[model samples]
Target: MLDFHMVYTCGYWSGSPECGLDDAQQQKLNLVCRNLNLKPGQTVLDILSFAKFAAENAGAKVVGITISKEQAALVRDLCKGLNAEIRFEDYRDTLGEFDHIVSLGMFEHVGPKNYRIYMERISGLLTNGGLFLLHIIGAT
Candidate 1:
């Protein structure tokens, strides 16, 4: 199982110092998810989610994917009592016919060479009116 300490330590979980980089990143992610206009009962895809907070907060059905099988299982365990489904798959291969898609701190793992491909893949999964919210960090 993947240790959630790294993810939970981020401000997204709750409290954190203003100087926390993780907090800043999570703030950006939360804003994007909220701006997506997620609705309850909607199918939401969370690619490479570590905490599944956005999906849970939206009160939507979630399909979460992680590259690590064990980590995916952990996510499944965490969401066992909730309306969430967790799986192990490369984000590139995951299927999504969702009303909303949210991903945070994951796109950076995809090299620039694969960024467009990743974007295209996610875009292809949306309904004509679906929204996709991505929180990415660019190198300074």
Candidate 2:
């Protein structure tokens, strides 16, 4: 289960200390889009659905994938009227090159055994000069 506001990942609080949870989450999304230099009509492969709506709002074509059908449905509904597609699929099964790839809070599920393979797959999916942002919880 996630928070009541549907924010499942950590927030980026450095930008606005006085912001509430929702604002902080939105700030994090904006920061990622800005750092990635996403442009209008660019294709973005979002491993998690968190950035789908935000990327679409920034005028990018977002393709968000999640292993859970429920999550996919929810994202699809939330992203209505935007250039976004949410799918219930695994990242390894994803195809097509993207101008940007973003994975937040999903790497931990890949585990150490599949880390290299996951990186290779992500690399292969990215187009030349494409940017990738991986935000994960590292080991202690």
Candidate 3:
């Protein structure tokens, strides 16, 4: 139920209805990178792999993790020759620290039972003053 690109996430229209799906997606990616203030040679952990490509394009060393084997393989293939690493692993098992962490549309799976654990894991993964951006749909 989406465009051919299969990008299932929020889009930044910038008040232009003429914007194509890919254009909107690119806009969102740029916005994320800008807000994170990513720098060259910095480390980034992209949980869910949504912003891996964008972060890589911004010259950051990106480590993207996905539980789905298919997705992991897809990202690896798509990001070939770029400073990006795609891993098929659960976030609970992730290692090392990151200058920035970005997770989109994946927190719904964390559930209330594992919310504390999830937050703790994220906290442990981040470096001092590291930025984390989480985008998820929820009811208030």
User: Which candidate ranks first by lDDT, i.e. highest?
Assistant: 2
TM-score of each: 0.76, 0.90, 0.90
Error of 2 at 6 (Å): 3.0
- Segments of candidate 1 deviating more than 4 angstroms: 1-30
Q: Candidate 3, residues 33-115: lDDT per residue as tens digits?
A: 88989888888998864545554568888898889999888778777888888899999999999999998778888998999
| Tens-digit per-residue lDDT, 1-140, candidate 2 | 24433657787776555777777677777888889987889999988745455555579888999999998888888788888888888998999999999998889889999999999999999999999999887878
Q: What lDDT tens digits, residue by residue, belong to model 1 across residues 6-117?
A: 3522244445444456556556455655698767788888775634665566678888878888878777877867788887887778875988877767877788899889
Give the better candidate number (2 or 3) by lDDT: 2
45, model 3: CA deviation in Å? 0.3
- Model 3, residue 30: distance off in Å is 0.6
What TM-score, to 2 decimals, does candidate 3 have? 0.90
Worst 10 contiguous positions by lDDT, candidate 3? 1-10
**Candidate 1 total steric clashes:** 0
